[model samples]
Target: MMNEQLLDSKFETEIFNSQIEMKSLFYNLETEIQSNISNLSDFAFESHTDLKQLIISTNVTLQDNLKALQTDIMQQLQQVTDQNLITQAIITDFKSDILNNLSAIATYMNNNQLSMKNNFSFTNSQITNLNTTMQTNFNQVIADVQNTNMNIKNNFTQTNQKIDTVNAQINAVVTNNQFQTQIDLLKQQIQNISVSVSISQSMTSDQYRCLMIAAWYGSYTARDNYFNSEQYLIYLTDSGCPLLKWW
Candidate 1:
């Protein structure tokens, strides 16, 4: 019976040893699982922090670009306004200069027109005065010519009357009876005197007959002398006879 009791005690000791080894293995496996879970959680948290920092940097860059674009647009608008103001000023000055030049030209034209009108009026007055003076001189010349013609007619009438009276006196002398008797006696005496005297050869026959008649009638002084008186004979010849002088 003592041997049997010893064997039962050995079997029980082995079973207890097996149970202790199994419990040790289970504890080691649980510890390894807990360590792997802690590593995974830390990796996820680190990734989240890096993504948030990248988003904040991109937002800051966008805001700075917008501000720069706004500043450039405002400067362009101010430049356009300044150019428009300069163009308006230049146009205003050109219009004012044109108006001044036109006004000066109009004034010069008016002055020239007034001067031409005055000259035309003076020329007309001078022409009228010249015409009047010419008419007056023409009338006076006509009156002077008429007076000269009247004086010439009066002189012609008086000369004709004197000629008629001289003709009547010559006719009376030719018809007298006493003058006929004296002419016959003078003819006889001239014939006798011519025979003795040397008569001038230059005297024509008609001239000698006229001289004897004038001396016998005593129209000029007859000296009481014969044909021998040289002085008396010379006076009769030099007379050329009064009838020739009258004619």
Candidate 2:
């Protein structure tokens, strides 16, 4: 389409140039014929005769040549003028086609833009919905996680309290065992002393009396030392050993 338009413009330019050349040739020929006729007129006037036959013949020949040149110029001008009219028509048609094509392209772009705008609007709506859904799900997930954390914390607290209770019971058991062990040791020592004193009955009187005195003094001092502790007294009673009530 563009190439056709360019060819039309070139054709118009050539036709215009041809018209200019025709006009220039016509003007030059007309000037030459007029100058020759003026010269013939002067010759006739100088001869003082209306029948200047030689100058008249020369003027006739010039007129004929001038007429032929004028005819040729007129024909060329006519052809150029006809082509100019055709060029004008073609230019008008080309302009109309160009305007139509431009209008069609503009309309197409407008429609495409409108479609894109509608699509964008729909896409934006979908994006918004997706974001809303994501946010809602995120909130739900957060709430579930927080609730789980709270439950875990509660479980840990309850477990720690149970562990404390178990520890207290274990400590009580250990303390009771230690007290029983000490009582058993004291009972074993008392049994050994009793066996020794029974076997010493065959000893001399002085040695027997001295051993009894020492045992009495040790028992009296031990009773006075443990009088302030009820647990010690309970342990002694549980061991099957009782203090003598000599006081």
Candidate 3:
């Protein structure tokens, strides 16, 4: 804009200078016309009268032509002035419209910025809430897992205690029972009976049967220790087994 204004001022200055030059040319022409008339009058004879009239007439025509040229120049200058005004008006209106658009754009940006800020705030709030919820849930899950682990540990401890109790009971029953003592005593009695019987290599069948009966009833079992022994004794009296019926 500054450059353009400078160029416009320069153009106007040039036009002013041209107007001054034209005015100077017209003034010089007028002065030369006066000098020529003075020279003609100073030599005026009856024969020079027609030449004087022709010079005067030519000078008037030149003056009229100069006036017409000045009028055209002034009209062109007026047109240039009007064009400059129109251009200035157009530039002013363009500046105003541009300023208005810039203002509107700024306003629009502000409104959108406010809306975006609100949206971001809402999103941030939601994210914060989600994070809090996740933290709570995560903490709860951790507690549940700890509880589960504790329960598992408790159950395993109980199981181990129960196994220990069962092992203690089994050890007591195995170590403190009288069955092995009874079995050893029975074996010793059987050895004593065999040694007594080896006093004779030969024996009657009845005597052998008596010794077998003594081993069966006394060493292996006792009739007085049974609750329902009479039925078995009756069956044994008529037993079909070869060893029981040898007598």
Best by TM-score: 3
Off by over 4 Å in 2: 1-116, 119-122, 181-247
Task: Tell me how far the alpha carbon of residue 161 in candidate 2 is from the true structure, in angstroms, after superposition.
Answer: 2.1
Backbone clash total for model 3 is 0
Worst ten-residue run, lDDT, model 3?
A: 40-49
Mind giving the per-residue lDDT tens digits that candidate 2 earns over 1-247?
A: 9999999999999999999999897676656544543443343233322223433554475566556655655665565566556555655655565566557557755767776576877645654665676566556556655655565566556556655655565455334343344334443443444544453334345434433433443354334422222453454355443231111
Can you write out model 1's per-residue Cα lDDT over 1-247, one digit (the tens) per residue?
8997888888888788778876675555444433432332233223223323433453354445445545544554454455445544544544454465456446644666675476867645654664565455445545544544454445445445544554554454334344334434444444444532332244456555554554453432223211222453465456654343322
By TM-score rank, best first, the candidates go 3, 1, 2
Model 3: residues with Cα > 4 Å off, grouped in runs: 1-116, 175-177, 192-195, 200-247
Ten-residue region with minimum lDDT total, candidate 2: 238-247
TM-score of each: 0.31, 0.29, 0.33
TM-score-wise, the better of 1 and 3 is 3
Evaluate model 2: give its lDDT: 0.50
Each model's lDDT comes to 0.46, 0.50, 0.51
- Give residue 182's error in model 3 in angstroms: 1.1
The model with the greater lDDT, 2 or 3, is 3
